[model samples]
Target: MVNNTDLTICLFPKALSIPSGFVTLGICIGNVFVIVSVYSIRSLRKPCYIILASMALVDVLTGIFGFVAGLLFALHGRFFYFGDTVGWLLHKVMVSTIALSLLHHLLLAGDRYFAIMYPYMYIIKVHNRSVMLTLIATWTIVILGLIVILSPYYSKDVQNVLEYTFMILVSTQMYAFHLRIYCKAKKTAGQVSSSTCQAVQNNRSDFKAARITSIILGAFSICILPSLIHSIVIETQGECGRCRLPFYVCSMLAYANSMLNPIVYGISNKTFSDSYKKIFQKIFQKIIRLC
Candidate 1:
């Protein structure tokens, strides 16, 4: 077993570190784009879109805390800049963000399902004030959970177990939501015939939503499974010195999920795509005028 003192938590070889830093930088930028696009476009000011904006905010924080901070730690090779307390706080923030990100994915899936399955009820139940309250409640729960994780009540082993258990539960809930959405969408499509142009357009929109849901799930599973599996293995077996590299790689992959959502969901949607194009075009024209 590598002693906690001896084990370098964030250090990576030059080859790996450089690439990881680049990936993290890209994630930060992509998440920022999501935040900007959601707020800048007037058409995207609905409940579901507000949820997306909130998700992007979580992702942006994740990129900064999980990836960017880790990169800085790797570069410094120690906690010389921030000291031990900052490092500990960063670790807590990373875990908290990861939990929030997982919950947010499920939240998004549930929001979509509700909007599709109970459109009228959703309108009444999930209004702007309700959405705001829900978000606040979620963050409050997460913060409380973080307090427990940081408290001395749980030993390190217990903490690991709790974290893993939380993740497994979240994963299960997300999958259940995905399956429910699929079945509901299928049933809805079966009822709504594509006989009229409007009906056909509605069907196409549903299909697109399904495709986007699949992409989100696919990206999440790919990025998260590696880390989840690795964590489980580490928990089962005692610490292996050689496991550090793979753990770091898997962690990077998990954080990469933050980047993939904007590309898959935001750019794929027509409204956001058009907004993004206009935003970029204006920025370039301004640059040209400045020059």
Candidate 2:
């Protein structure tokens, strides 16, 4: 007779496990490059790239947590291989890191918004120290908030409600901020004086940064929304037999987001892309010397 564990194992086929392993690896490797490029390149040591580096750090943690969970799932063919408590802890950590990533996106959007809309203020107020403080504050708030929401004091339903509400609010604010930035850029395009070539150049650079961030935001939204909706459906309707496949799909999509940001950065930002090329060239040279 087939046991329940066997059935569970069957549900999580090797097909899913194999791809998940690859995706987790991709997330870790891609984000590591982002962090290294940002750190090694002196030009990237600015407030904007600083925020991106922090985001990459958070994504690396997210990838680590996902890898651990996926390893257990792959080994046991079931989740929470270490038991429910450990599993829930891992889940909370994953959730928190993802929340941090989203918050970082929000920060990036706000950073660009201020840079373009209130350039004088941004120049005066936004610096490495200020950006670091904002990042620290963001981390503290999200960690504390997650601890509260995921605490045993709240029932599962309450936890779900709170999480959903937080995600929605943050996402909405990000959208609004990016929209304003878009409008501001459009309105100011013709107003910049051709006489001040430096001013025009600066304006163009700011807009380019804004455009890259917008693309990142769009990729994040597209990747995460399906997972968000899936969670809502699972909570309200409960998981049916058919839910298993969609659950895997949604999860992979969510995990894919961590890997997408670095790709977007490489493709959209010339500085980052150039750094990537140089890094690869150096790595190749090292391998050749070793041989």
* Deviation (Å) of 87 in candidate 1: 1.9
> Which parts of model 1 have CA positions greater than 4 angstroms off?
1-10, 67-71, 78-83, 188-193, 197-207, 241-243
Model 1 over residues 1-291: C-alpha lDDT tens digits?
212342234445556657666777877777777778878878677666777788888988876775646556566764212335566667667889888888877787777777666666776788778887888889899999888876755467777777888888888887887788788767667556545676456555655665676688889999999888887787687567333778767877887888888888655798877776787798899999999
Off by over 4 Å in 2: 1-11, 80-83, 191-196
Q: Tens digits of per-residue lDDT for model 2 on 109-166? A: 9999899888889999999999999999999998897778556565666767877998
Taken over the whole model, the C-alpha lDDT of each candidate is 0.73, 0.82
- In model 1, the Cα lDDT at residue 96 comes to 90
* Clash number for each model: 0, 0
Backbone clashes counted, model 1: 0
* Every model's TM-score: 0.86, 0.90
